[model samples]
Target: MSAAWVLGKRALREGRRTPDALLPTLFIPLFFLVVNVGQAAKIFPAASTEFLHGQGYGAFQLPSSLLLAASFGTAALFLVEEIEGGYFDKLRASPVPRSAIVLGRLIAELVKAVAITTVLVLLGLAFGISIASGPVGFVLLVALTALWAVVFVGFMQIIALKTRSAAATNSAGLVFFPLLFLTPNFVPRDLLTRPMEIAATLNPVTYVMEALRSLILEDLEWGTIAPGFAVVLALGAVMLALNVRVIQRYD
Candidate 1:
C-alpha cells in the first residue's frame, strides 16, 4: 500500500511537470462549452420550448463537457517511458505487488479527473447552468465524473500493458471521441433517429450522459443515475480485470 502511495505521488509529480499533456483535458471541454452555449443562447427561447424539458442548452451540454474533461488520461505514458528506460524493471524487481504499479497511476489519474470535473462544474455554474438537485447533485456529478474517468483508465491500462507502445497507448484515447458523440451528446435522446437510438441504447455512454443530464435537469432521478452506475461498474470491472491479467502475464 505504501509503495502504491509512493507511485501515485510519482504519477502526480510527472503530471505537474508536463502540464501541456494534461491541459487538453480541460481545454477541449471549455472550448466546446463556449461555442455550444453561444450557439444555444441565440436560439434559447425557441429551443427551450422543444425537447429540453424546459431548460437551457447549456445545462444540457455541461455534463458532456465535464465528461470529456475528466475522461482524458496519460494512458500509462509514464509507465511506458519508465519501461523503455529500464526504470520500471527495477521497480518490478522489487517486492511490491505488481497491481500496485498500475493502480497507483490510476489513482492519480482519478484525483486529477476529480479536479478537472470540479473546475468544469464550477465553470458551468458560473455560466448559469444550475443543478436541479442543488449541492447534492453537484457532489454526485464529481463522483460520477471520477468513476467515468476511472472506467477510461481501466481500458487504457489494458492497452498500455498489452502493447507497451507509447504511440499505441497514447492513441487509445481516440476511442472516447466516437463513444461520446455517437450517443445523445449535442441533443436529447428523444430527438435521436432510429439508428442513433439503437446505437445509444447499446452504448453505455448514453446512460452516462442521461445520468449526468438528469442531475442537471431533474431532482435526484434515481432511475436515471442507477443505470449509469451499473454500466460504469460492469464495464470498468471487465476492463480492469483484463488489465490485471495483462499485468500478471508481463510481470
Candidate 2:
C-alpha cells in the first residue's frame, strides 16, 4: 500500500515536469469543442428543437466536450516512457508487487482526468451551459468521467506493455477516434444514416454520450445514467484484467 502511494506520487511528480505530455490532454479537446460548437451552432438550434428534449446544442454537446477533454491521451504514454527510459525495469526489480505499479499509475491517471474534467466543466459553465440534472447529475458526470479515464488507461497499459513502444502506444490511442465519432455526440442518433446508426448502436461511447446528455440537459434521468455507468464499470474490469495479464507476462 505504501509502495503504491509512492509509485503514484512519483508518477504525478513526473507528469508535472513534462507539461507537453499534459497539454494535449487539455488542448486538443478544447480545439475540438471550439470547432464543433462553432460550426454546428447555426443549424444546431433548429435541430435541437426536434430531439434535444428542449436543450440548446451547446448544452447538448458540452458533456461530450468534457468527456473528450478528460479522455484524450493515454496513461500508456507514461508506461512506454518509463519502459524505454529503463525506469520500469528498475521498478520491476524492486520487491513491490507488480499490480501495485499498474494500480498506482491508474490512480494517477484518474486524478489527472478529474482535474481536466473540472477545468472543462467550469469552462462549459462560463459559456452559459447549465446542468439541468442538478447535483446528482454533476456528481455522476465527474464519477463517470474518472472511470472513463481509468478504463482507457487499463487498455492503454495493455498496449504499452505488449508493444513496449511509445510511438506504437500513441498510435493505438487513435482507435478511440472512430468510436468517438460514431457515437450520438454531435447529432441525435435518430438523425444518423444507416451505417452510422448501426455503428453508433454498437459503440460503447454512444451510451456514454446518452448518459452525459441526459445529465447535462435533462432532469436526473437515472435510467440512462445507470446503464451508462454499468458499461464503463464493465469495460474497466475487462481492460484491467487484460492489463494485469500483460503485467504478469512482462514483469
Candidate 3:
C-alpha cells in the first residue's frame, strides 16, 4: 500500500508538471456541454421537458459531459511513455508489487476525476442546473464519477500494456464516442427509436449516464442510481484484474 501511495504521488506530480496533457480532457467535454446546451436548450426547455424534471437541458446533458470528461484520461499514455523510456521495466524488476503499479495509476485518476467532476458540476450550476438530490447526491455524484474514471483509466492501461504503443493507446480512446452517443444523451431512453433504444439498453454506459442524470434531474432514486454503481463496480473489477494480469505477464 505504501509503495502504491508513493507511485500515486509520483504520478500526480508528473501530471501537475504536464498540465497540457489535460487540456483536451477538460476542454472537449466543456465544449460539448456548451454546444449541446446551446443547440438543444430551447427544444427541451425546463418548463416543458418531462424528462428534465423542470431543469434545463444542460442538467440532463451534464452527465454525458461528465462521462466524456472521465473518458479522456491520460494515465495509459503515460504508462506507454514509461514503457518506451525503460522506467516501467525498472519498476517491474524492483521490489514494488505488480498490483501496486496498477493501483498507483488508478489512485491518480481518482484525484483527477474529483477535480474534473467538481469543475463540471460548478459549471452546470452556473448554467442553471442543480442537483435535485442536494448535498448527499452531490457527494455520490462525485464518488461515482471518480470511480468511473479510475475504471476507465484501468481499461486504457490494458491497451497500453498490451500494445505498448502510445498511438494505439490514444487512438483506442475514440471508441468511447459510439458508446457515448448510443445512450440517451439528448432525451430519455424510451424516446429513442426501437433499434437505438435496444442498443442503449445493452450499452452499460447507459446505466451510468442515467444514474448521473437521476442525480441532477430528480431526487435520490436508488433504483436508478444503484445500477450505475453496479456497472462501475463490475467493470472496475474486470479492468483492474486484467490490468494486474497484463502487467504481471508483460515481457
Q: Residue-wise lDDT of candidate 2 within 159-213, one digit each (tens)?
A: 8999998888888888778878889877878889989999999999888878888
The per-prediction CA RMSD against the true structure, in angstroms, equals 1.8, 1.7, 0.8
lDDT of 3 by residue, 40-155 (tens): 88888778778989877888889988999999869999999999999998888899898898899999999988998998898788877899999999999988999999988999
Candidates in order have lDDT scores of 0.82, 0.81, 0.91
Off by over 4 Å in 3: none
Backbone clash pairs for candidate 2 read none
Reference-based lDDT, residue 74, model 1: 72
Q: Which segments of candidate 1 are over 4 A away from where they belong?
A: 40-47, 50-53
lDDT for 226 (candidate 3): 99
Candidate 2 has its poorest 10 consecutive residues by lDDT at: 46-55
Residue 76 CA error for candidate 1 (Å)?
A: 2.1
Evaluated at residue 34, the lDDT of candidate 1 is 84
Candidate 1, run of 10 with poorest lDDT: 44-53
> How does model 2 fare in lDDT?
0.81
lDDT score for candidate 3 against the true structure: 0.91
Per-residue accuracy of model 1 over 33-96 as CA lDDT, tens digit each: 8888787656655344564566678888888888887666674777777878898788888899
